[model samples]
Target: MEDMSRLDNACHRPLRSAAALGLVAVLTAGCTGTDADTTTAAVGRAAVETSPLPTVPPAQPASQLTRAEVETAVSRLDGVVRDAMRRTGVPGVAVGVVHDDKVLYLKGFGVRTAGTKDRIGVDTVFQLASVSKPLASTVVAAAVGEKTVAWDDPVIKHSAGFTLKDPWVTRHVTLADLFSHRSGLPDHAGDLLEDLGYDRSYILDHLRYQPLAPFRAHYAYTNFGLTEAAVAVARAAGTSWEKLSAEKLYRPLGMDSTSSSFADYDKAADKASLHVKTGNTWRAEHVRDADAQSPAGGASSTVRDMTKWLRLQLGNGTFEGRKLIDADALEQTHLPHIVSEPPHAPAGRAGFYGLGWNVSYDDQGRLKLGHSGAFALGAATNVTLLPSEKLGIVVLTNGEPIGVPEAIATTFLDTAQTGGPTVDWLTFLGPIIKQAAEGERSPVDYSKPPASPAPAKATSVYTGTYANDYFGPMTVSAKGGELTMQLGPKKQRFLLRHYDGDTFSYRTTGENAVGLSGVTFTVGSGGRADKVRVESLDTTGLGTFRRNG
Candidate 1:
């Protein structure tokens, strides 16, 4: 599954809390085959149970492929990737295919950056984004294999600092729950904290103030929850998450090009430059430091290294005849722990969430386990394995909001199944992308104007420092008849233009500005605004900030 945390809306707008939820709702509405329904389970939690996993018919054994057959089946993939790049304007991509536990094809196409001659290679490192989840889960699986931690153990047992708003949830949430994304927090619940320059530890500490859904009631994909789980695993293993992942998975599999640290990415000789499309041009993007949330989506790797990782996954924790983890422990990560509410597209027979993978049966009744990673407006990645066929494919691209990786994955899987490329993936996906972009740009009225016009307050009354427990300080300053609000650590300043009453439309300035949103100030006694509320796609609600000075 794509990391909802980083995915923008169909219109390519800056993703806020509401837009993120709305996008999920729109995309997943077809997944459930019905309206959004919430059910109260016998366990006293409200859960949304949608389509259940389809029962797999008796397995069909896959045929062994000769080297020639594999070659013939994959000969068209290069053309496919090249055509996709031409269609989507993606700068560079690395493709890898593993069949029957052997790397059949691993190559790179296009240049590392637009208008640059430097080519992406098999070892060109790119941020794995949410794809880091499975790797982190594998490390935890290794810890489980060592008897250092049990999957069902409460997170508090390992990390005493772990907590949530509800005492019961804090006591009951387990490592398994965290991996499966069932911690009750909404999707990307603590992302604002990260946006405010808070580290993982601070984010975890502030989780006690975030609202909860239902404990074990819904599948909310939360990067913060996963980060906490990784911390718990690290604590149990007596090592940091990065160190544990390296020792347990990367080193064991000889994935020398992979590292969970951005520092390592910076030091790498060959790295794919991040890119985003702006006005029909693919522009390089600044690298984001994600080391603070490394456990959730902070790994950099290459197609060469990813193929090895895929081989291990297809081998059920074994790589090169070495059993790095117990087969049963590895299998547990693939088992469905939570039923995802909105079905992801190209709907499989049944969609479910495993520890670090999306477990579902393809339309052909083959078990398809995979995950897609998206670096915020930089890179896109996909890794898929069909254990029944001993087939896996990895596609990595340097582009924002593009479906090329997914298109490539699906086309490759289809080719493997039919012995030929039966799908024009670009042709099929182009319209969908266009339609999403159009739909996202459609205007929506979110304003509820006051019944009557109120007197305008003095500009000085609205200027002050407002504080949020999790997001830190926001200062509204007025000078020369203009008002601006500066966010905490990032100090992102947005120009505020009065709209109606105390509400003002704000547009971010500078190169990193996301987009326009609205903010409302609530005036109290003494004609001074005591509270401010912001409306944006990234926030779940108003995100009230109180006047502290």
Candidate 2:
């Protein structure tokens, strides 16, 4: 197995933060001199500074209000959202907050469609996009709760026609592998629109001829695998995936405004329009109907509906008068089965992975279980549950510029904390980072190397700035018989050596033992490095970087 832990140096971890109460003291200490003379002189002094000292009021007593108080403060948070929508080019957003089994706040802002005068409301339906994963995953959990499907059931057992490029790995792949995103396949393969073409069955049909990864590894999010998992859950439940979600999750949770389509969503009367930002303003774009990829990104819902779903999770999978689902199942969904370290996460540490949710810690190091999604030029969404505080947040936007979902979710939850409510995800999971090393297996990539090399003449076609709204800036410079890559200040002075026809590797200058564990660079026409791919240690996963020069 390739050791992904080696690539740990490629990314930086989030900064350590001080607790809210500790922040003031830390800042004060930093400002005050630490010299022995200063300490000696102040030995008999009062805690406060000398007389004419500015009367900085004592920190306001921590509010002891109820959840309703927190909700009310959050409800009046309209002004706090302008910047979030502005940065993401989203014209409107629907926000919801839930504490345990109750909906604390549900509201909307801006217009549903930018060109139109229609407004977004609490009941306005918008594309849930990848938020569908949780719902689809919930059904699978329900099936497990009822013994209809085993979490470890192999894909071939559920659907005999399935096959990958490698026959051996195909038969052995389990349903959990797909949902957990370790199934060798990447997010969307060659010309996804051409294969699936807005049709679900076609995607399943093409799965038979698709390639597989030799070794299942850590998380690399994939829509195809999750969709397959959704189908398997449907087959196990003896019903269609759509029907299963409606009956088991939607109806029981009273998510009347949620569905897999704009048509079905309209039944609720009040719904949000899908908007795409166009230079400074938003315009109504087609609602994403990637129903073919429904398991990955296809539900339409509102803040209220999502809040209700949050309550169910908070209530241990039961809602109102019905034990709609099992609490243990919900626990299973949040419990980390695989140790994964996603970007922006602390280095040399592995976070847990549930069925569809990527489990991690909030700024305070509290466990946070949630799933975030984005649709190209459509919308971005985030739903998070902090079980310890029995609090959750649902943030939906009609536009996305990457990272908006995570930012919004964090901001809202942090804001909620200021008002009497206290919810955290980590406190419930007992030292997740220190858990056992299970060495979970992910999908294996078996694609063969390219046939022949391109003509050998180089140009400066690689010199320019390529930006991914999420990953940050990548700069490539070539000079003095060498090419170098600078990914946000971290410079790589290395020789670009060719491997396969389109692939190349890097050898750091004057550095023998400190070589990059694994890296593949692809030069396009004109012998220009147009793509840079860092292979995961397992070689089954990928973090692809396209040439933007």
Best by lDDT: 1
Top-scoring candidate (TM-score): 1
State the lDDT of candidate 1 residue by residue for 1-549, as single tens digits. Answer: 124221222322333211121233233222222100012122323222322222233464454435565566588789878888888789999999998788989999888878989999999998877788888888888999989998888899999978787777777778888888777776666665665566777888877777777666577777778889988889888889889899999999999989999899888889888887888889896676677778777888999999998898888888888999877677778777776634445642234677876665544445566776665457777777777768788888887645677677766655554566554655654344433322222132324445574655789889999988767788999998889998857687778877677878775332123455678899999789999987652355538899995
Which regions of candidate 2 are displaced past 4 Å? 1-76, 86-89, 190-198, 261-263, 266-269, 342-349, 362-365, 402-404, 418-549
Q: For candidate 1, give the lDDT of residue 264.
A: 96
- Compared with the true structure, all predictions reach lDDT values of 0.69, 0.53
lDDT of 2 by residue, 1-549 (tens): 001111110110100010010111111111111100012113212211332111232222222335764566476456556655664556778788777566766778888767677888887887776677776778777777887777677777877777655555576667777776556554332113222132566556555444444335434445667777778778766778778888788887778878865458655556666554556666665544566666666778888888888887777777786777766665666655444443333332344456766555433444556665554435667676666667777877776323344445554554565542132212211111111111112222213334664643353655555553223355666777455655423343445554444344553221001133234556666666666664422132224567663
Sliding window of 10 residues with minimal summed lDDT for model 2: 12-21
**Model 2 deviation from native, Cα RMSD in Å:** 17.2
Off by over 4 Å in 1: 1-70, 342-348, 421-423, 430-456, 508-514
The true-versus-predicted C-alpha distance at residue 425 of model 2, in Å, is 19
What is the Cα-based lDDT of residue 31 in candidate 2?
Answer: 17
